[model samples]
Target: MEQKTVTYEVQQNVATISLNRPAVKNAINSDMHRELYSAFVQANEDSDVRVIVLTGSGDAFSSGADLKSVATEKLGDIDYGDYLKETYNKLLLYMDTIQKPTVAYINGIAVGAGLSLALACDFRIAEYDAKMGISFLKIGLVPDAGASYYLPRLVGVGKALEMSLGEPISAEEAYRIGLVHKIGQPEEFVQQLLTLPTTAYGLMKNVMASSYEHTLAEVLQMEEEAQTTAGKTKEHTMAVQRFLTK
Candidate 1:
């Protein structure tokens, strides 16, 4: 059997999608993208998977785009924009649309598109010493894979531009600047994230994502509708009953 470039595993309602190409720091390649998309789709469809976690195997989360594959293509003959529109954009759109809570467990360095992948997640928990940045400028390119959309929203325009134009920052600085939700030992962070009530977390993530682009009135209405939907969930009903008993 051939090894998968991306591996998906579900345990106790948590679905983990791991980038398996540790030899090249699990860089994003065409095959990995296909595998990742499939894995995410499967996780989203699985009734038992309440939360989805994305991480990479080995020491690095991902170095960035697979330059090796890029080298194989005829640079001038390829339309990079079309390439991104077909692959990464689809993946990003799927991540955005999924109602399940998604967490990016940045266990090590995440650069360029790797950082963008992390940004796509609703929450990011990185190893304390991990490094992250968008290094597209270094290579005479602009940030892709939704970095342009997510980074500025995450760390603010000034900080986002600075990071894009400069070097990678330590996870500690990333957390301080609001780029990441938390920095801790990977295992501890994963455990804490998994403890969150999945239904509530998903609804909250939807509200937060909507807040970025919606007017206050629109968001309030969305929140009202979401609350109604959430209130119908068995988890919410059970929790409410428990509270009443208490």
Candidate 2:
């Protein structure tokens, strides 16, 4: 079988989605967009997969859009907008909504839509040298693939505005501004990423993301509901009972 543009592999309970065109820094074209969406959906539906990590293979995480595709001007196809909306925008939104935890392992440069994809993840852990940007303005384009929405919320209105106006941010700066959850030495990033506790991370992720769109009262109700549901879960019940007995 041909290795797909986006490759999916499961190790333990983690489903890893790797963007595979390293030769071009994983610049996303239409095929890569489609495959990425499919991979996230497939992982979400797999009960065996409790967490998902999205990464790219190479010295760079992803350089965002493949310039060749834009140069071809094929975005004028009849269903082009809809196709992009579903495959790119909706896919990231779905990944955010999945009850499973999603991690963006930013091993290198992440620009344009690539940065947006990382923002959509529940947590972002990056190598010290990893760089991120909202560089659409530099290319005379507006932000797409959900950057306009995800970026501001992550780094505050003023900073997000500054970045999206087209400057790049380093991994250290990103973490300082709360855009990344953690940073590791480039050589140790992959190993450090696997240290997250899957189940606890998943539960906390669902709660936090849901809070974004919910009213305070609604969030309280949801918190109660989620707590009740979690109380019945094996992990929750066992841990709580064990703690009480101790």
Candidate 3:
């Protein structure tokens, strides 16, 4: 794809959609939002891509919305809610429905909406030196880009509230609280995800996300339906065959 703010590349079944604004630490702007949505579409449509990775080109994943652009605009004229409705709402919703696993490679600072973007991913692998937090409070803004929904789910309501009122935490702290899957190379997790059954992963993602909001009986029904779908896949059939033969 011919993109400006985001770069798209696929390697070893992993489609890497990198935020390309390294000069400003990959801070997202309107252009970046458009490009990112397109890149994700491209990745989702590609048959070669088993996993999708969101990362940054420089030392940071993203610094969040481009405050420089905001500074230049008339504050009274800006409708923040409209901006989100037009921009990331669709992108984040589409990401939730992605059949492939997604990983956020937090190489450095991921604050504000940038942190929210990372939270949208199924797995987050933060570099050891990365700093992350719900940093919207510093700028007198509430968390957007699905941060408000995802943050509390990962770290519990109490910790999420504390982080909202405080500074960015270290990658180690993030890992300790279940914010990130690990603190190391993103490739390690991506490679492992690629080796898993893609169909099962997608099914599990749907069921697990539903598990949080549904009753036990509802979730059990969801698992029953998902398992029926999974059991029909060639991968599952092959595994069953191999097991019986052994």
Which predicted model would earn the best lDDT?
Answer: 3
* Residue range 104-221, candidate 1, lDDT tens digits: 9999999999989999998899988799989999888999999999999988999898998858899889989998888875556566766666777778888987797889999999
Candidates 1 and 3 compared: the better one by TM-score is: 3
- State model 1's lDDT: 0.87
Q: lDDT for every model?
A: 0.87, 0.80, 0.91
lDDT tens digits by residue: candidate 3, 156-246 = 9999999998488999999999999999997777878988889998999999998888999999999999999999999999888988999
Considering only N, C-alpha and C atoms within 3 Å, which residue pairs clash in candidate 1? none
Candidate 2 Cα outliers beyond 4 Å, as residue runs: 71-80, 185-204
- TM-scores of all predicted structures: 0.93, 0.86, 0.97
* Top TM-score prediction, candidate number: 3
Q: Predictions ranked by TM-score, top down?
A: 3, 1, 2
RMSD, one per candidate, in order: 1.9, 3.1, 1.2
- What does candidate 2's lDDT look like per residue over 114-189, in tens digits? 8888888877889898989889889677888888888888878899889988788898899999999889743244
Stretch of 10 with least lDDT, candidate 2 = 185-194
